[model samples]
Target: MIFFYTARAKFNNENGADILAWTNYIEWSKLTQLTELVSIDTSINEVLVETDRTSEEDWKEIVIDGYHETGFYRTLDHVLKKKILKDLIS
Candidate 1:
């Protein structure tokens, strides 16, 4: 199961306001949705930061199908949660 975090903006422009108010909202979604968005807009790759989840064969297949090409390949070293917390506190 692949999961991803998406951060988006909520805007309010009620009562004929001259300016817009916006708030940042974050949510979690499955890989399927992400692939759908990618299929619609390939430009998303500019801001996409994929993690180590692509290393698995099943995950890789889904990504390749979504991307419609095999050229976009990347790998990053996986990190442990304990090490991440230790670094954060120190």
Candidate 2:
């Protein structure tokens, strides 16, 4: 099993205003969600959604299907990796 930390912001405003609170691994959608966020940043290579606010914090364990990704390499051997094979070729 593989587990990656995902952090989401709870803002006082709807548009992420004031970062009211932070949450870790709210769901298993990072396979589809993280890719979008990471690709938006040019200098970033990977999208790290954390369970905590600190950059060094870690999260729970999960079997990540790295396949359903968009703008990066999919090297994981798990089921999630299959999602990116199609996107990778293009």
Candidate 3:
């Protein structure tokens, strides 16, 4: 499966800090691909994933878990590059 994702930072008034939030748009041709990618690329201790199977769109929503926003972004960049290269070669 191929997935597309975007992330952003939002300010938390109560905490007076910025939090990392990511929204993953997944192409569900293969269900396990995202899991595999996340497992291999990240070492985040607790991961939470929620899927919206009821939507009638081609892309489904997936939320990835990570406390370190910058680290997650770096991992995402690396994974995307690897996927692109694999796609191009094959």
Q: Pick the lDDT winner.
A: 3
Tens-digit lDDT track for model 1 on 1-90? 643232211222332322321111112332322212323233332223323455564254323546464333322322233235445777
Give the lowest summed-lDDT range of ten residues in model 3: 17-26
Q: How well is each residue in 1-90 modelled by candidate 3, as lDDT tens digits?
A: 644443322222223332231212233333433432333233322222212246332122233355323223223554454445555777
| lDDT of model 1, residue 55 | 55
State the RMSD for candidate 1.
Answer: 12.2
Evaluate residue 9 in candidate 1 and report its C-alpha lDDT on the 0 to 100 scale: 19
lDDT of 1: 0.31
Predictions in order: lDDT: 0.31, 0.30, 0.33
* Local distance difference test, candidate 2: 0.30
Model 1 lDDT, residue 65, Cα: 45
